[model samples]
Target chain A: MATKIDEEQLMNDMLCRVKAVNNMPHDIRATLLDFKVDGYKVGKVRPGIAEMLCNMKTSVFELKQEDDSKKKSYLTLTSDAGTSSEERTKAVGTVMNQLRDEGFVKGWRDELFPVSENFYSPPVFLMERAAVTVLGVLEYGVHINGIVQESRQDEPKMWIGRRSATKSKFPGMLDHIVAGGQPSGISLIDNVVKECEEEAGIEESIVRAGVQSVGAISYENWDPKSDKLTRAVQFTYDLYLPPDFEPKPVDGEVQGFMLWTMDQVKESMAMDYADPIKPNCYVVIIDYLIRTGQISPDSNGFLDILRELRSGDCQ
Target chain B: MATKIDEEQLMNDMLCRVKAVNNMPHDIRATLLDFKVDGYKVGKVRPGIAEMLCNMKTSVFELKQEDDSKKKSYLTLTSDAGTSSEERTKAVGTVMNQLRDEGFVKGWRDELFPVSENFYSPPVFLMERAAVTVLGVLEYGVHINGIVQESRQDEPKMWIGRRSATKSKFPGMLDHIVAGGQPSGISLIDNVVKECEEEAGIEESIVRAGVQSVGAISYENWDPKSDKLTRAVQFTYDLYLPPDFEPKPVDGEVQGFMLWTMDQVKESMAMDYADPIKPNCYVVIIDYLIRTGQISPDSNGFLDILRELRSGDCQ
Candidate 1:
């Protein structure tokens, strides 16, 4: 006889993996700097990154005293209120590119993400996708669960992707069929359609017709080693795939795709489960189960996990 | 031009109805008393009601000093640690019945609700259903969305009921097909099965087979005039009904049942929409929409409303 799964604990474990602040030492946590722009908090950075920014001797950075007693200062973009988004973007980009040159930032994706209050809001500025993480900037992305349901009566099967081992971040980890960062230029739905075609080789027509914008999950990822205090919002969608539809790796982002049942997905979510799913992908999948009632109200950890799912700064 | 519905604003309006504390005056909010039992907080009460309990001069309650400057006191159930649930219930019942006789509490249901940490935990004690509201006790219930779907291709239609005008709470307001309080003795699924039979004329077998425990929504309702500071969790279920399955109102708790299209359901959730749905029912439906993708990630108020949906003390 096997022991029953404590999904609540499993979810908490998953939560701790992404929202790493929970397990971080107090000293490391204490040294985290708030990244602000035009008086709006957009992200955070580690003390080392903050110190580097403070020493930049450039008009783009300003270290302001946030607390006198703690001798703590916050790293703020010197972009003033009423500055044009373009100017703000250029100012931030110059500093970010400098950090990249100094080897302080890694995984330099030339892509840019809107630094805004939320997913749909106009960007206060756009920062390079890779540099954004190091600055602990709020990042937004779209993740689609490409699911196959033979009929409405049957349990839906999800298409999971294994990221390319050579890729920069979470490489070779299991991922969604179509998941991509919400770059500054594209609409959320457009990002979905683009990622669908690029990552999973799904046509835009099939995606437009089948994709349903489901919900969003927000979480803060405090990885001191990565210099990331990232608060992220993943706008989630579900696309019902035909039984014959199979996801293939179009871009090298994914190595392969496999369709798994709800139970199989849950099994993978277990902390000790083999062939690990990407940490945040686990968050998205858990949310999907909650919506579909596979992980339901009767479950011991339902409410606890539900609250923790949005445990990050959403805006 | 037809103005678009501000679902977020609409949700906020609905939330204000149930989580009444937001619109309450500073004085009233200040006078609110915490209700604790055996060192665990389980409910709250307004000062007038708090004073009444203090004057009752019964061993059932103790009015203890909390904040001297604010002259604030918390009303605690005097049931000691290690007290048997049976003894705790009897002692509290005496205070509750006395409060009922004095015209402080009304709508006596002769029903009891378990006072626990969450839905599944063993209750510290059982409380009278009606008095639970006055004490602002943590409440739990099950609400089922009865929907008619002709086929997988068609949008599901909800079986919405008009509450009986004679009902004590939310009289004549719109409600779910099957909704009921989680009584002390019944399992959640059993309560759903029972409510289905009594409210919708649905059989136990049909309910057992059909009810999918989707999720739960928690909210706080503070109505000063009503003397309610209720923090409630409604465990939600979605039951698919065949086209021929017309919900006949078995009990007079409902005036009538009408199957509404998804659009109609959304219209009813609007603050200005005619025939307002029950306040917390609005919370549940919004959640359902979020899950089903009717209220997508792009909705301006999506995250705002989602966060506010669980704006109550869930545990």
Candidate 2:
């Protein structure tokens, strides 16, 4: 007899495939041109950078010729002009400002993200948070999910929020109680506490007392639309709230909040074809389900889901 | 400042590197040649199969020439000889018996393992449990870990076992209270109960009542010594026991049992340089630590470890 493909299995398979795409190495060698400075690999430069740089006539950057190995030529910062990390940061910042002014990039928050070989190393240089992906550099984020179960109930329920319609990405989609990207300065715990209050209107005292660190999920994806490579590590947290406490949207990013039972959450997750939740959020929920023993090993594709959840590198 | 590498992070990094090795894809396209039965990809035959087939003078099997794609030539079964699944099973069984007789293979068991594209697919054929790895076919195993904790403790201690000195694999090494591969014909729950009795001498009533399905971890590794690709899916279970109950080894596989605190377990896992436990078994214990909130997100390499745990595909 042929094996039966159940709803849970189908959902799990879909998530796994998504993870594979995200975890697959960025073939910058094949797609974007490789940029190097002073014998060190800097980052990937998008193809469109040539025309943009030409239009801006930047003194700090130049388009270099392909080497004998036939690797694609790249737009690199002039080493004579900016040899030091500080000078390079300043030079790149100037180009980023020009790009932002020309309407080539959006959402300039003045926040900086480190461009590094791996997370556990000193960054080569810092770039604007908005332009990190545009430059195809690795970035990291933190996602704090609140598990608000009624004290009297036998089964726990999860608190979920809807992204505001005005949000630039994943607007009107379901999200965790609180989620945000990790910028250069703040620590993970501090970020979680800050996001809890700003995103969910949760009190600082409650968040500090109840929040527990769970784990993380990482994935690397190339966005063809933006011609960017996005390598992200999402640090996940579980915050338990009092049963009677209701969450209000303090920040405009969240539209509304709702508490759903496990069955309801699973049902939502099983709609793999639908965009009920943001893509990465789906993985975080699946990880929660597996860790909490809601997704049993006997379930179809349980192993597939577990293996896919950790497919990417954290560094 | 240079990025601070903490002990936890270092341990997590070590675990991730180990997982990467285990999870890396086997280029079946490169090392072992592929064998096709009818049109379906049946199995991977080792390079040595050519000489072995010639030595045995087998009528059912023949070595095919390499194709234009430059793919490796394979030792395939003659179509006219084994059309039906049963016939194919019998034909392969005959060759496997011959190989065993010739001392090319070892550890022959009457038990069968299903060879399939994925865990959910209808198996192409059944092979002797011990011979599955010899053929380099994708294999699935269930690893049911008994999480025995004392009822009286504030922070529960775990029941761990040391393998017998006479055991062939991982002799005198640490192991779960109960663990065994999923043999054919037995359901996961039934196998868990049986393994619990045989390995840990747990009562049937206690196992049936306390055993809970948790999740699974999948990894693919190429065994250089045997020149075989090992694809495994371990179905993990958590069998909670009362604090006072002691685990006695019924089967001689386990030499002794000990109850260790979380700190002790962490210390053992942190010993990345030593093979304190079987490699894959280390992953299972890490999963346990993460699930029980012993390994926090704040812990160094926590994210790396989480991602590595789920780095392979079961399907």
List all candidate RMSDs to the true structure.
4.5, 5.4
lDDT per residue, candidate 1, A225-304, as tens digits?
65666667788898988889888888898999998877677667656667888877877877788777686566565676
lDDT of 1 by residue, B1-315 (tens): 235656676555544444433234455666677887766777778877777676775646778876557666788866442387888888888888887887878889898878876566788888898888877888888988897765546787888999998999899988988898877667778889889999989998777766677767776666757677767778888898778878888889998998888877766655567778876677777777777777656656566665565545345
CAPRI band of model 1? acceptable
- Count of residue pairs whose backbone atoms collide, per candidate: 3, 3
Candidate 1 pairs with clashing backbones: B18-B221, B19-B220, B20-B222
Q: What is the TM-score of chain B alone in each candidate?
A: 0.84, 0.79
In candidate 2, stretches whose alpha carbon ends up further than 4 angstroms from where it belongs are A1-56, A59-77, A149-153, A203-205, A270-275, A303-315, B1-56, B59-76, B148-154, B203-212, B270-275, B291-293, B296-315
Question: What TM-score fits each model?
Answer: 0.86, 0.82
Clashes of 1: 3
